[model samples]
Target: MSLRNNPKKSMKLPLTTRTNQVVRRKLQQSSGPFPRQSTNKPQRRPTRIRTTNPMQLLSNPAPNDRAEEQRKLRMAQNRLSSRNKRLKRRQLSRVAKIQHTSR
Candidate 1:
């Protein structure tokens, strides 16, 4: 007997992205007025990602153009970090003042 005829005995496949694509293709083929497939290629998730230290950024730069872009991003990151530190300091000082005033 064909696997499709026996739903309970059908092969159990993992719900992977490729499996999803196959299922969708089958569904579109069976239905009338099938929805248009997206023109954009599906973005596959990266299998492996690399980790690098943020502080090592300036020391280990990219190619000239990319290096410049990295510099700009680093500077922006530094400014934001400093701004956050200042805000935290102010918050702590306010709490300290409230405690001192109440004592």
Candidate 2:
């Protein structure tokens, strides 16, 4: 009952006749290596957007607003340094206490 031994009938066409038909059709529709018509267009360069000056905006800030911003910045720096100094003092005291207790 294998497929190779099965005896189903079929219609057969000659291979050379079929191949010639395909080749003739391909030759009729063949195109050149280079395109027949140019489809590409030249690209335009991009333009830069204009911007306003930052100093002008800062200069026009509401009265006292600029002064308040400067004060806040200075206070932030002071707090950072104070915290660092406090940490160093605590470390030194802890080392000193450890040395005294060990002796």
Candidate 3:
């Protein structure tokens, strides 16, 4: 009888064993995704830990010198000048609004 009509006759020979052997050989030759892990090897540690506070450097900063004092004075003068300019602009806008309303 034909092997198609009797699959048990095909398995009675070395055909099914040959296919299993070929599949096992292919699996051993190729490194699939699930490679066997070794318990003897230690796990890898991260290079750097990310749990540090970013503002720790600002907590203990450099000592203020004469250059720092000069910078502070310049910043204060700039703030005063900007405030005066803003007040002048507001006063001019208010005068223009009043003139327009009167007209």
lDDT of each: 0.75, 0.72, 0.76
| Most lDDT-accurate candidate | 3
**Model 1 lDDT on a 0 to 1 scale:** 0.75
Question: Alpha carbon lDDT of residue 91, candidate 2?
Answer: 100
| Ten contiguous residues with the weakest lDDT in model 1 | 32-41
Instruction: Mark the regions of model 1 whose C-alpha exceeds 4 Å error after superposition.
Output: 1-62
Candidate whose TM-score is highest: 1
Task: Write candidate 1's Cα lDDT for 5-56 as tens digits.
Answer: 9876554545586588887898887855344555455799976433377656
Question: RMSD per prediction, one decimal?
Answer: 16.9, 14.3, 11.5
Clashing pairs in 2: none
Over 4-73, each residue of candidate 3 has an lDDT whose tens digit, in order, gives: 7998887776878969988889879877533445445677987643334647534533456446867998
Query: Which 10 consecutive positions of candidate 2 have the poorest summed lDDT?
Result: 4-13
| Pairs of residues at least 3 apart in sequence or in different chains that clash in candidate 1 | none
* Residues 7-76, model 2: lDDT tens digits: 4421133678658887887767876322433445457889654336677657565458788988999999
Better of 1 and 3 by lDDT: 3
TM-score of each: 0.40, 0.39, 0.38
- Comparison by TM-score, 1 against 3, better one: 1
